[model samples]
Target: MTGARPRNRKELLAAAAAGLFARDGFHNVGVGDVAAAGGVTASALYRHFQNKQDVLGHVLLTGVDELADRLRAAVSGLADDPGRRLDPLLLAAAEVSVERRELTALWRWQGRHMREADQKDLRTRVGSLLTDWLAGLRALRPGLDPGQTQLLCFATLSVFGSVGDHRATPGAGFAELLARLARAVVGVDLPTARPSSDQWRTRVAPPPSRREELLTAATRLFREHGFHAVSVDDIGAATGIAGPSVYRHFAGKSELLLAASRRMADRLTLGLEDALATATDPADALGRLARSYVDTVLRSDDLIAVYTTELANLPERDGRELRAMQRGYVAEWVRLLRSVSPGLDEAEARVVVHAALTIVNDIPRTARFADRPGLAAELTALTGAVLDAGATQP
Candidate 1:
């Protein structure tokens, strides 16, 4: 009856765990929650997963299977040209990313808690996946290394993940974002901005601020690179502070994480509060809010990454508050949308608002104007359009 029936049971557990994790977060969801959702006991869940992390490990591995299968099939439908295949693969990957955002976030979140071995395995699988996909892209691109390729790859799938995380419309403008990622990765000569030795010493960045410099620098570094990819020394070096001195400012990277998260949560709620007060109407409010959000995102290509990737690393209480803050923001948006429509009840309004917010939240993923000659205005127009639709008078 129980001959290692982990895959089937595991998929159910993963799906259930993903729902709860996405609903709350990793730290909030216990083994019992996952087991209950899967209609099994915690003991049963443990059989497939050593712990919550094992659930995430399966989600990640499942993503590889699902995305690779989808990409391979989707790529077949595209023209042989590398540029053409890029979009199709991106579309397929984006779809999967949206469908899988919760687990994807978990997979990302695990960077905080998973053992070093699990983390290494995850990296290896990811690199192998990209190396294979990049092989298809190799004929079109030359001279790109794994580092560059990996960044571009992360940028590609991440856009969709953001869309899903933020709730982008299933079909709206997804293709455009895909095109942008493809073009940016291939068409643009985006040479990494390496400073000369003297320049590195001069212009890389100033020494850490005397006032909360260590914390600020660490947050920026973790956000700019990644929690796993960055180190305490990197933060210290960036800010011209002592690595050990980081302890004076904060307990460790995890504590620093909560601080960064608190900053974001404060901003999110504050922004929403301010936006609502000034808004003339719900739609105007939504547009203004969406505009502000997009503006922030455009300036911060790494903003969503900070929210999605590192939030999990924060200590438990802080992470809960941040999630609550986000929920409140979304809930506020939904309430405003309902006021605008009057036609939809609260639940219906939430459905509509969430769908729209998802798209608005996805600007960083799909926006290409930053690189496009006149694309900024185009992106602005698109941003306005979504806000308008969400905010438009009934």
Candidate 2:
């Protein structure tokens, strides 16, 4: 089926590869799958990309180029003022959430699996776009330092990327909703003083059972190296066990992933339930939940990372059950937010909830705030700002 025009054929192959990589993990999809998806034979696909890695690099690098180009084009015709230009630039980005959903997801998930040199190239390209955004944002908010500007830019991007990860369709108004939420993220005032860290504590803990030790080791490896890249023996080595000792604790690597993912989900579900018990009202309950989430993420980032990224590697039945539990956790947040903001519809509340969670999830990765004082308070305030932004949408 090698029927595409010579010029368009490469693009068709790249597009097919992006969709396949986004739908299935990059490690899971093979050159044959991409060739099949693009309506071409393996030989034809190779003419465009040297191999599957090459295909991934092409999709990711080009996708980043297009995203930056969209932001640039969004402001090209507008006034030179940064504040005046930001609206259209953001709206254009939000529109991409719908138009280029697969490409967006590819940038977020598949880029992580690239080879070292490819990963460096991808980061450099993404960093350049982020610098451009910071330049404009600094112009608008001269009070913000480069760190704050970078955080805001990444947070805003995360909001748009959330559309690809979820099934929510807020009718046709999703773009506007995303734009509003993103603008709120950008408009947030970063804290100047380092937050107080007295409340943050580390536990001096004892040893765990062999099964628990294996799960812990698996979670860290899966977070660092991806799920498919790590093997049962890798988990065993990480736990100081030899050879097939890992098998006694778990059926296989997938079961270890499922255990780590389910543990994270259960912690979140249980933590929120515990917070709601003593809340004075819905607002307090939401605030408590937000703080608890930030603390948990800050402490167990590896677990959270694996839970977010590696759950798809689980067997279909296990993956389905885990995802159901996750959705229920998010649904609890939706219920609490709706209680606090009665005017927020289900979709609006869900978007805001995700925006808030996105901040918690992405901010810690920056590493700047990982050891900063008042981290929880700052994140909680940012979450509030996102929720407040959603409130003004209607």
Point to the candidate with the largest TM-score. Answer: 2
**Candidate 2, backbone clash total:** 2
Clashes of each: 7, 2
Best by lDDT: 2
Give TM per candidate: 0.54, 0.90
lDDT of 1 by residue, 1-394 (tens): 6755555777778888777876665667789999999889888777788888777666666666666666666655333466667656766665666566666555544444555676677677666556656665555566665544444444444434444345434255444443443334344343444334112123466555454676667667776556756787787787777778777777788877776666666666666877889989877787667655644554444444476567666677877778777777778877766676665555434434443344334434444423433223333344444333433333
Q: Every model's Cα RMSD, please?
A: 8.5, 2.7
Off by over 4 Å in 2: 1-6, 74-80, 192-201, 207-210
lDDT for model 1, please: 0.58
Q: Rate the local accuracy (lDDT) of all candidates.
A: 0.58, 0.80
